[model samples]
Structure formats: structure tokens, C-alpha cells
Target: MAEIETLQELYVDELKDLWSANDQMAKALKKILGQATNGKLKDMLQASQDGIAKHTDVLKALIEGQDEKLKKEHCKGMEGLVAEALKHTVEEAPKTGPVLDAAIIAQYQRMTHYGITGFGTVAAFAKALKLDDDATKLEAAVADMHKGDDLMSELAESAVNVEAVKG
Candidate 1:
């Protein structure tokens, strides 16, 4: 662990944590897609996976631009989130149909909120450090996460939650 004595160091370390979170979520999402019975949910998950890949590459570029190594610190928080998702979506909850879809959407929104907060924090840190370009990129990432969260909410309200109650 790089001893973070300065804000710059802390920012980079936080970026690495976020990087790890994105990668972990991407991997978990592949499994999630299989569990999704709804076509729209499956499609949204696919798009989200693609977005994660793109954002991860952007983060790597930002880190490398700062002359920092593009290494990832394990994101334990996301690990727990993923575990919780699995418990609800796989272990304790229904295996398929609308019920699982609703649970998956709930878990996905929770995870997206984490990304939104993390990216927003990094953007603030970058702004404070006068890294305007990095701040812009991070803010863009935050926007993207917010949009994804909104999409999940729309899907839940329009279909998943209703079907869940009926079925």
C-alpha cells in the first residue's frame, strides 16, 4: 500500500479502489445476465457491462496520465455488495421470473449508487487538486452511473415490480 500522505496520493488510491469495483461489477454482471429472464433487463445489463468496460479504460488512462501505475486495490465494499446481491438474487430469493428481476434491479441500483458516490467523490478530489480534465471525466462517469440507476428504476416500475406482485 502506498503510504498516502497527500491528497494526490489519496486520490490515486481511491481511483484504484474504484477501478477494482468496476472490474468486479463487470464480472458479476456476466453472471447476472444469465439470471435475467426479462429481455429488457438482460439488454440493460448488457449495456451496463459495456459501459463498465469503457469507464474502466477511462480510469486507467486517467491514472496513467498522472504517472501512477494502473493497479487495482481490492474493493471489499463491492465484494460485500455482490454477496448481498447473490443472497437476494440467488441463494435466498427466487431463481427466476419477475421476483428475481425485481431483486436484481434493487441490487443493481444499490451498486450504481455506490459508483455514483465514488465517482462524484473522485471528481471533487480532482477538482481540488486542479486536475480539471480528470474531474471532468469523473463527473461524466457519475452522470453515466446516474442514468443507469434511473433506467433500472424505470424498468422496475414499468414492468419488473408489477410482474413480481402478480407472479
Candidate 2:
């Protein structure tokens, strides 16, 4: 990683980091999605994976727009989150039922919140640098992440959590 001496450098670096994060999260989701029991949860996870891919493309475009190399800095932050997500959802996961589904939702939300924060921060940075177009694109990515988070929350509350409580 290059030393970021200016805000623009930091912003581009973050974009690269986010690109890496999205790739990590997407790979993790592909594994986790198969473990999900709830139909809605499965659908949402699949959709979220698609969204992550789309966001990665956007990040790549943003990096190129900044005349930066189309490369990703490994995001240690997301590396940790992905580790925990896999830990709970796959390694130590409960049987394929509501309990496991509930755990999946929790892990998924943790990852999603990380994305929300990272993208929101980049959007702010873009705005601060008067990069209105970049800011707009990043903010849209943030919104899409939030939408997935909301769907997971709804699935948990409306069904998964309730079913888990019965066990």
C-alpha cells in the first residue's frame, strides 16, 4: 500500500480497499448462502451477492476514473469480518434450520454494516473533494447495501428469529 499523503490518495486507496472487501464478502456469501434455510433469506443473499458484484464494478470504474491502477488493496478490515462470518455461519453453524438461519442473518448484517460504513465514508470523502459524480455513485452503493441489510432484518424479525425462539 502506498503512503496516502493527500485526501485524494486516501479516497482512491479506500476505493481499492472497498473493491477488495466486496470481492471477499461476495465469495463468503456464496458459501453462506447455501447454508441458509429460509427461502426469503436465500433469495436475499443471492440478490445481495449480485449487488456486491455490481458495486465491485463501480469501484473499479471509480479507481480508473481517478487514473489509478485497477488493483485492490487487501482490506484487512473486511478480512476480519469475513473470517467471523464464516466462523459463525459455516464452521460452528447450527443445523440447517431456523437457528442457523438466525445466525446467518446476524453474520450477514455484520458484514453489510461494514460495507455501509466503508461506502458512506468514501462518499463523504468524494463530496469533500468536490467529486460529485463519484460521491453520487458511492452513495448509491451505500443505499443498495442498506437495502440488503433491511431485507435481512425483516427476514429475521418476521420469521427466522421467531422460529429460532421456538427451538
Per-residue CA lDDT of model 1 for 42-81, tens digit only, reads: 9999999999998998889989988987799899999988
TM-score of 1: 0.97
User: In model 1, which runs have C-alpha deviations exceeding 4 angstroms?
Assistant: none
lDDT of 2 by residue, 46-107 (tens): 99989999999999999999998899999999999999999999999997599999999999
Q: Per-residue error at 116 for model 2, in Å?
A: 0.3
Instruction: Assess every candidate by TM-score.
Output: 0.97, 0.98
Error of 2 at 112 (Å): 0.4
Look at candidate 1 and tell me the lDDT of residue 14.
89
Q: Cα deviation in Å at residue 117, candidate 1?
A: 0.7
- In Å, residue 85's CA in model 1 sits off its true spot by 1.1
Error of 2 at 73 (Å): 0.1
